[model samples]
Target chain A: MDSAISVHGLRKAYADVTAVAGLDLEVRKGEVFALLGPNGAGKTTTVEILEGYRRRDAGEVRVLGEDPGKAGAAWRARVGIVLQGTGEFDELTVAEVVRHFAGFYPTADDPDRVIARVGLTEKARSRTRTLSGGQKRRLDVALGIVGRPELLFLDEPTTGFDPEARREFWELIRDLASAGTTILLTTHYLDEAETLADRVGVIARGELVEVAPPSRLGDRHRAPATVAWRTAEGAVEATESETPTALVAELAARFGGEVPGLTVTRPTLEDVYLRMIGEKA
Target chain B: MIGLAQRQGALEIRQFLRSRESVVFTMAFPVIMILIFASIFTWDITPGVSFTQYFVTGMIATGLMTVGFQSLAIQIPIERDRGVLKRLRGTPMPPWVYFAGKVVMVAAIAVVEIVVLLAVSVGLFGLELPSTVGKWLTFGWVTLLGLTACTLCGIAFSSVSRTARGATATATPVALILQFISGVFFVFTDLPAWMQQVAAVFPLKWMCQGLRSVFLPDAFAAQEPAGSWELGKVALILAAWCAIGLVLCLRTFRWSLDR
Candidate 1:
């Protein structure tokens, strides 16, 4: 009952194809959960069903404690959704679009403050069509959060952002999460999931493959670590070790202190995600 | 909800005004057509009714049909393709409010069209204004009903196409053909028997007849197909169309691309 989202035996199909099949998942309140999958992996379909934008063929799906399929305006008001891309409203300025969406919810954030929070303060009066791809993505986020909803859904939010913009966006999302907004986002970007999500859920073929904290995905922390270093002759060497700490100490003693470029690295989230999806496929 | 729809309507109006081609076509072109047709026709439909007056009323019908049905039919599908409707669906506002906003804008355009067309007819062409309270009331009800029917029909018809170009293409053929057969561009009586019979089934024909009933003198009603302006039938047909359109719009409107 405390969960922000819950689904059991969920199923959806279009004509001859099933999009989400017998999926089960739960997102707890005030937690940032990232749903990860590749293209055509039913991530969008599942998110849309949870967002109440589409009906599932069969399921007991509850978002904010209401069945999204039968939820009304009050239920919708408690949920904020940033869809994949809402690139229209070309004639509206940033402030205008944000304010317009703010009108829909009973409790809303200040549109100007929301725009400023998204780092679009200077572009408030600029028409939406003139915004860069990254700026548009920011605008989407601003509008999504303007409702001050109890739950928010972000679908591939930083898809076209530059590295810096993506980082800033991650900071903005982190700020929202810190304010106790339950957020569920979908992304193919494993790094983004690692930085932003408190827990990451991997989905494939309309099923939940794994759900765990980012550091624990693919048993990454428990997996063997690679102890790597540069030798005095400028040659590099690395070796898999169960105890990278012991290995680092041994290397430091052999060099009589400060082994060159000494480091212990674990598998990246990308490596773990790819291996998981690859194994499923 | 109404307040939000009004804001949305005002936004649509601003966007409409910003588009030079749409402003020229949706608002100005009708006035231009009125000037061209009124200037070219110098005869009377009967003894006292000048072709200019008849053309004026018919052009009023043309203006409503264009704004209420043709332009909206085009805009809605384009909005859908642009993900505007989909985005609105995500908001707390009811999806129907989006179309309500559109209806407000289109209805406002239809009203402006009537005013401008009437101004041209009265100020330049010396057409007589309706003198009685009854005639004015008739004008009021018919215009409201006609705009509702046409705009609702436009929203319903938008579901016929998935793309903007397809909507425009679909709306144009039907609207233009109705214009020709229902007396928008010429005398309704002069059309071929088959064309007149075909036009009778649609609401635009009743809309045209209803406008003529309000604007034309009582004697001019003699020229109508039933030898009368048939105001009662006009109201009935347009009301029926409004009911039918509401049903279809509820059934066919799409809030998002797909599941």
Candidate 2:
């Protein structure tokens, strides 16, 4: 299948600082792709170039088989963007703002349906400025999806959201992905990526260092598991081993059954992410 | 594009009316200034051309300043700073559609201010009426031309403001300076000759002169510049400035202050 996004030798510079160095990326259609990076790591610049909001100094890029640099309004209609900041249209109620933006697209989802999907139905009549931070972010997401875009770009869409709200946002993203929308998401939360992304790419110093499935990224699943248990001495003990199951079995034998606070902890996506970024830096 | 323009125009008008603070500032400031100048300034250029007529003309100019310069400069930059422009940019609406809506709304407000000032002058102040349709036509065209010029200049000024606070600083000084030099603050005849010459280079002077041409009698024009009211030259100059300002605004405008 053709990829949703393709880039090769992409580079961008401003004045004396290089924001995006030569980089290559490809996102297959109908998949959720997460880009992990630190601040000022050229992630935003690269995304802007892909969104046709900025010009690249040198690059080859095609989003959904059309050059983003030359894509017309029709192409823009097929793409959605959830930016990092909120808009304060004080006079516009939630329903009004959503309906207004929905009218711009040729084939828009029902504004009321989109608002309800984003959990803003309760505040539909409330002015946008009066919404809470998470509610405002939901409005931004609602605007992004009103057009029913084929590809959606989300930039830290859950930054200010509470843990519960963040999980709800993850479900929303999953639903969009299941409906065949390709997603390119950028976020600092590793758990969000692990929960939502099919594949994740790590970027550092304007370069892509790694790309793989969330479970397989950076040998995380294969990394030695830490086996911990409370001993008869009333203290904890631990050991890193490739055979965690055997260790647990031996501990079970000594404990005459369920190992005391027995836990085999594996390296999480965050642990692998920090190690990769630390090494790359 | 027209549909988007209509929608945005309606939204802007609604928003402007709802914001009591901005409505008071933009709509009320010019009328209050008119009252202040009419009460404080006693001199007139000629015996027949009363300060009342001059106050009405100055008020019209002040109304243009409020709608064209103050409204766009303050509102546009603040919207951009707040990410309103950026969010709009992501939408499928054409960029020009947003500007078209802004211009239309500003023009409507300018027209209302002009009408109010004219009523105040004719009904209360007893200013002389235009004797001919040609003179009234000239008045309409001049106001249109001046509104166009100010609208374009206002968009251009929006680029200089990165934040809401800086918006006033960016646009207000230019408006005040032009008004002062164009005889909105005081009688132009009282200023030094060099100051009048400098003011002549700006659109404000032609706009004020054009207002006087429509309201004051023909004999008054003979005593002023160019011997008689040159409606053609005023239109051409104002159109040229409008073109230049529009080009600058479109080419240099940024959706985000960071850009």
Q: What is the DockQ of each candidate?
A: 0.68, 0.68
Interface RMSD for all numbered candidates:
1.4, 1.4
lDDT at residue A276 of model 1 (Cα atoms): 85
Candidate 2 chain A: worst-modelled 10 consecutive residues by lDDT: A83-92
lDDT of 1 by residue, A1-281 (tens): 78999999999999988888899999999999999998888999999999887888998998998999889889988888899977468878999889888989899999999999999999999988899998998999898899998999999999899999998999988998999999999998888898899999999888899999999998998999999899889999999999988888888899999899887888999989999889878
Q: List residue ranges in candidate 2 displaced over 4 A.
A: A255-258, B42-45
Clash number for every model? 0, 0
Q: What is candidate 1's DockQ?
A: 0.68
State the C-alpha lDDT per candidate: 0.88, 0.86
TM-score of chain B of each: 0.96, 0.94
Per-residue alpha-carbon lDDT of candidate 2 for residues B1-259, written as tens digits (9 for 90 to 100): 6778888888888788888998888877877776676677667668777776776777787788679877898889888888888888887888887898798789778877777777777876667778899988988888888889988988888988678789988688888888888876666666788988898888887888888888887788876666776777788889988998899897889898543
Model 2 agreement with the true structure over A101-175: per-residue lDDT tens digits: 988899999999999999889999999889999999999999999999999999989988999889888989999
